[model samples]
Target: MQAPVQRQCSHVSTCELFPKFGLRGSLRVWQVFYCLGNFEGCARYRLSCEGRAVPASLLPNGRELNIDALVGKP
Candidate 1:
């Protein structure tokens, strides 16, 4: 009585989990993120599968990274 793979949602828009199978009941790893938009292109913000050390561009508004939103203690 389990769900199908495609129907599963182990990944979040910000970060994702590996092991497409066991991911059903496991904690996801922490992957730090940088600003998405840049003077170049959005693809530049994309992370590599290897998770290598790459320089990322930081944004001022970061319209996405609303630190206050993350700290949901209200």
Candidate 2:
């Protein structure tokens, strides 16, 4: 018999298949990143669904996260 399917949550934190999808919307799209190490320490780095733009505070390890450079022309 075939196994039953499961539904995934829209939230980035609780979902395991988050990487398979892009953080897309009418204003902007963001690449979903999963922190493999130190989940507690990297809690602040997780992207928030509250805004269209990528927050500078979400930067991890002082690395430059340029959203404009990553976005493609529509």
Predicted model with the maximum TM-score: 2
Where in model 1 is the C-alpha error above 4 Å? 1-4, 7-45, 48-63
TM-score for each model: 0.20, 0.29
Residue pairs in collision within model 2: none
Model 2: per-residue lDDT, tens digit, 1-74? 98755332244464332332244442122222324433333323344433344444343343554554335434
Residues 1-74 of candidate 1 have per-residue lDDT tens digits of 87743322222343322222123332222121222213122232333334643222312222333333333335
**Count of clashes, each model:** 0, 0
lDDT of 1 at 47: 34
Tally clashing residue pairs in candidate 2.
0
